[model samples]
Target: MTETTRTEASKLMTEVEGISGAVLPEPAPAEAVTPLEQASPQEAEGIRQRMAELDMTDTTSIVQFGARAQSDLQSISQEMLSGVKNKDVGPAGDSLRQIVTTIRGFSVSELDVRRNRSWWEKLLGRAAPFANFVARFEEVQGQIDKVTDTLLSHEHKLLKDIKSLDLLYDKTLNFYNELGLYIAAGEEKLREIDATQIPAMEQAVADAPEADKVLHAQALRDLRAARDDLERRVHDLKLTRQVTMQSLPSIRLVQENDKSLVTKINSTLVNTVPLWETQLAQAVTIQRSREAAGAVREANDLTNELLKANAKNLREANAEIRTEMERGVFDIEAVKSANADLIATIEDSLRIADEGKRKRADAEKDLVELEGKLRHTLAAANSSKQAGGAV
Candidate 1:
């Protein structure tokens, strides 16, 4: 492990020890306690024994462990995304809209009894309004039933998603814990190599005879190589642990979304639907009361109009009768006009008689004068005849 990683790990161990009240082993010292080159054969033998005790040369299993954790994280991510995608609440919203539209389409006007129905229709209880109203109610109920079924189906799916998320959360935590254990073990192995094995092997290489030095040096080289491989494995474990840390919150967020959607679905099923149905029932009752009240108001208005019209006609008739009862049979103005017309006709007849008498007197005088003239002419003719005979 890197120095920073080791420091963090040490801090974590301290915190864990404090919480649990358990004593852990102290870390190895930075430098070796004794020089291996100047040591006796028994001391060198002890060094070799310690090296054997801390051997961790084979790292294939450790590497595979980290690779498995990484693979599991990828799988968890894919599953989490799929669950969230499948739990969509859009269909629930669509159902709510349908319910609202169905409710709005219901009309109280349909329940009003017709004013112009024939007498027989009313007597036989054959008014068409109530029938239409009942049909409207049935239609609304059918629509509500369909929307309710849709909402129920959506709620079921959301519930399933919530249960699945619970399992995913637990799996993510397990991976997190396993990575931590693997990293901690790798760190311990690395510490042992640095603190004890590498130092002892170096001393052994320096103190060996000229003929055996090459073998000791090769042994030291092999030990160092193992330490490098162990560090690489610990680094991989730390990387996998980071992935698990990020996944923990991501899973919880998706789970929370699912839970919120479920709560909304429950509210729609338990509260809103029941309240809307109750309100629709109340609307029908209120509409009937309104129709009854309207009929009474219309009757009162017609009675008032008739009373006013009769009173006006009676006032006019009484005025005409009173005027006739107080009047004379023959009005004085008519008698006076007739007498004046009769006198004017008599005066015109007297004037015509006077004009006729004067014309007759003038005609008599002219006839007497003409008779005298004829007698004188007869005497003169007799004389003329006598004179002629004497001659």
Candidate 2:
């Protein structure tokens, strides 16, 4: 017999109970005994509760999510002007001269990753970046934990990942709840820099020094490239958030459906098992437990109706997401033009570096040959003078 079964009988009803008024122990609290009673229920309820808590399964979206961003549009000299004023402009005209020359000598390049964002995504991200931000942070933390464990010998990747998510989630929530308005206000300032400040500054870079222009140009190109990468990543993230969010209810439906299905199965098994067990033990049998019989009958009808109605809706949502994924498109021309001037300045510098190495090698070889010729000429001249003196 099970430990539970052994403890459950009426203690065999002591003999001479009429003379000695048989004593019985107090019953355990209902809450305390409840789990014990449910233990024979096959643990299906526990699994069902846990299944409800997960949010990842019902997802069918691939929409990006994160902060709204504009791709790069400012050049090197313009970048400096954006950050500085007249005194800083001291003799920049000379820098522009050399920068132009440097560009002529080197193979300049502007690099930007292709990226795109639709109005719908921009709207969503601006409306709710936190959802995507949290996911991004979690993903980053997972990568960190994986790398750190390999490099630092830490074994608790899951613990580390969860810890990072907890901290990031708390920090981000506080920022949005307390400081989001301030961040929203800062958006106007960024917009102004883009629409007014940067353009005017670029036009005024007319007299920058050649060397400064070269360095500034390269810096600007690098900066633009970095921004391009960020915008692409954010766009990708925003799309993810959108698709996942959309798929949530359907996924939850599926999860609830799954639990109902399992509960029915387990309840059916337990009901049948007990029907036989009870018959063997006490020669008593009930055709069905109330819950098992009801669940079996109701769940089949309920789930069948759900599949008939909601299955088509899930299929329609899938089509919408698939259309978006297939039509991946973005315009990066503006970004390239903005970084173009600075990139032009690097071409000359790169070429000069390569040519300088070649020139130095040739000069060394020439010097070696000249030294050998000089030694031979000196010996012949000395020998001619010695022969004339001997004669």
Candidate 3:
């Protein structure tokens, strides 16, 4: 009887495995797969052989994350060797190297995926519900694995976005800063024209009113157009500052939510899966008890063993599900504060640049005035000397 039961169980297990084999997703094709180790000469030879037998584009691989013992230098060296072994090209090699590089910096994959949840969502539990599944058993570990891949991919994109946005902001700020200085310099020169130069020019203009009107009108028009340009640039800077400010809440919320989700997923996964070793042990013990029973079995009692095993599983599953459902919310204050700081920086940077421009424009107006006065003084001196000689 015992031999019969064991054989039955083995057969059942085999059948289950067969069912699983059908549903398993095929490993992704390795277009740009690089690993985090230098394959030894022997391993390299093995890869070479493997490559020869197969399509290079069809290789599939698993990238391990959360191993902290390896240094960046070590990871890079490993990737270099792996690249040679696989003979990766173009996107495949680049993609594989990037995954290895990013995983090296973080604690785990949850820490890496930032796109789905904002920083605030993590703190406040707004999106906390989505991560519960990620916390479940190793049986569902593949779901968690998928999420991690998504996270790593997201981290790369966010990095590129941050760098690009920062570059634009920096360039725009620099342009405005330089333009402001020119405006200020022009304004200061305009201011410095001596009081008497105005009257002297008027007297000179009396001798040729039409010429003076044409020249002065054209010069005034040029100055006015320049003033309009400076005002437009300043106005554009202000609008950009406002747009960037409005984005702060969303950008910061994303970062906060991502961190929150990683923590929750880690807690759920650890709580639900490791307990399985205990569950399986209990299941085995219950089966043994049923096996040892003698002639005392009745029809109702015969079904009792199966019922007991199912009950234990139901209880454990229910308990874990309950705990996860009741998990507490996170605090969003940190995320809010960060948003405020970024907004403040945007405002402050714009103000500093604008202030410098205003001062420079004032200085230019003064300088222009001084230039006109100096020209007038030299003209008056020359005219008087000629008049004295005539007398």
Clashes of each: 0, 30, 51
lDDT of 1 by residue, 1-391 (tens): 1234334334433333332342222222212223344445765554444333334555554345345545665686687677667646677777778787888876655566654656886799874776666677777766766676666667667666666766766666766655554555456557778999899999998999999999999989887887887788778667756765776777667656656655665566556776777787786677677767888988999999999999999999999999999888987888888888888878888888887788888878887887888888998999999999999
Candidate 1 lands at a TM-score of 0.51
User: Which has the greatest TM-score?
Assistant: 1
lDDT tens readout by residue for model 3, 1-391: 1233324334433333333233222222212212213444654454344323322122221011111212333454454455344331233234434434433432333322223666787678653321332343332334334433443334333333333433333343333333233223322222332244344445555555785777765544544444344344335434444443444444444334433333332322334223433553454454345434432465457689779989999999999999878865644687689889999999999999999999999999999999999999999999999999999
Off by over 4 Å in 2: 1-193, 196-201, 276-391
Instruction: Provide the lDDT at 170 for model 3.
Output: 38
Off by over 4 Å in 1: 1-65, 70-86, 89-150, 185-240, 246-264, 321-330, 352-391
**For every candidate structure, what is the RMSD over all alpha carbons to the true structure, in angstroms?**
16.8, 54.3, 61.2
Per-residue lDDT tens digits for candidate 2, residues 296-371, read 8788989998998799888999999998888636436766775786677688788899999999999999999999
Return the TM-score for each candidate structure: 0.51, 0.24, 0.26
How far is 27's C-alpha from truth in model 1 (Å)? 29
User: What is the C-alpha local distance difference test score of candidate 1?
Assistant: 0.66
* lDDT score, candidate 2, position 80: 33
